[model samples]
Target: MHQALLVPEVLLEIFAYLSIISYTQTTSTQKLLAALARTCKIFHEPAMYLLWTEIHGLEPLLGCVTRLHPLIYHSGTWWDDSDEPWTKGVEPLSAHEAHQFLRHSSRIRTLNIKSEHPHLLSVIPAEACVFPRLKSLSLSTTYLNLFLPHMLHRCHLLSVDEGLQSFVTRCIALEHLCIYTPHDVHGTANELISDRIHWCTRVVTLSCPILD
Candidate 1:
């Protein structure tokens, strides 16, 4: 049975089935994929790739870096530099760790960040956190300004707020865009969309309601 499962075509089919099941069932997918990865050396790469493709939040991704036991900085007496430090919680990823994190992060194709935590966005350095394969992004209005620019260069689909007109111009490969214009800003949505129509050459689907 083990020898039969080692065939390349059979392994690909098995991995594909696991990917479909993982997408359809969100709650248990992570655990199941992690377990599958540990089952055998052959299953590890594909299972891990699927596990990191569609990340829902920053915690798990950050967990990977933290688990590597990277160095952490702490606040100390300004005058003495040698005084006992007192800062708590994990510090930002060191330069080396940031590089390692980015290597793994490059596999992510879809990222959905719904949490409102301000610090969550700071965990990874903006300049170093480029997701080369990221195609889909869902961000709250608050985080749009902070994270959009760093990711827009590669993202194909985006869900963001109306205030993104300035940033949308930078999305070269954006194919689908959904902007949630608030009531106060209803009148400007159309104008903004019209003015920026040529910003993203590949945009085929836009969902910004024009308020009358």
Candidate 2:
């Protein structure tokens, strides 16, 4: 049974199936994959590959670097009005930590950042934050302008705030774009969208509200 599982073709098929499940699941199961990696020498590389392939949030990815752990913190109020501390705010990773973070960033192909206050990203220097294998990015933050340029060269799918007028032009490789604009700020959002639509020649799928 061990020999059969060790066959090259069989191992590839097993890894592929695990990768699919990891990608489709809502909650990230990288920890489970990490555990599987320790079970045997042959499963190490493939298990680690699946664990790093698609990152749902920045915290787990940043957690890979031991030194950066102390810099991470939480800074938000509790929803239930309880005195419990919030563990969501993250301090900026230092230049050294940023470099360490970049080492793992290369393996990340998809990144989804949905937090209201994604302070963790601000710490990493824009130059060092480039993701070589990154193809998809979802950012819902007011600081879209800060990080958009660093990711533009490699990202093919993007979901960002509608107010980033100039940043939209640099998405030449984009095949899908999703813009989220608040109803109260529709005027500014519409103006920016209208001015920028001409620059998005590669966008095959565009999702945004009708601009008045």
Quantify all predictions' global Cα lDDT against the true fold.
0.57, 0.58
All candidates: TM-score: 0.63, 0.67
Candidate 2 Cα misplacement greater than 4 A, ranges: 1-12, 19-28, 67-91, 116-123, 127-129, 141-169
Q: In candidate 2, what residue range of length 10 has the lowest lDDT sum?
A: 76-85
Q: Candidate 1: deviation at residue 206, Å?
A: 0.3
Given candidate 2, what's the lDDT at residue 104? Answer: 68
Model 1 per-residue lDDT tens digits across residues 55-132: 775545554565432322213112112334222353545666555556567768887765444443465554333666
RMSD after CA superposition, every candidate: 8.9, 5.7
**N/CA/C clash count, model 1:** 0
Q: Which candidate is the best by lDDT?
A: 2
**Candidate 1 TM-score over all chains jointly:** 0.63
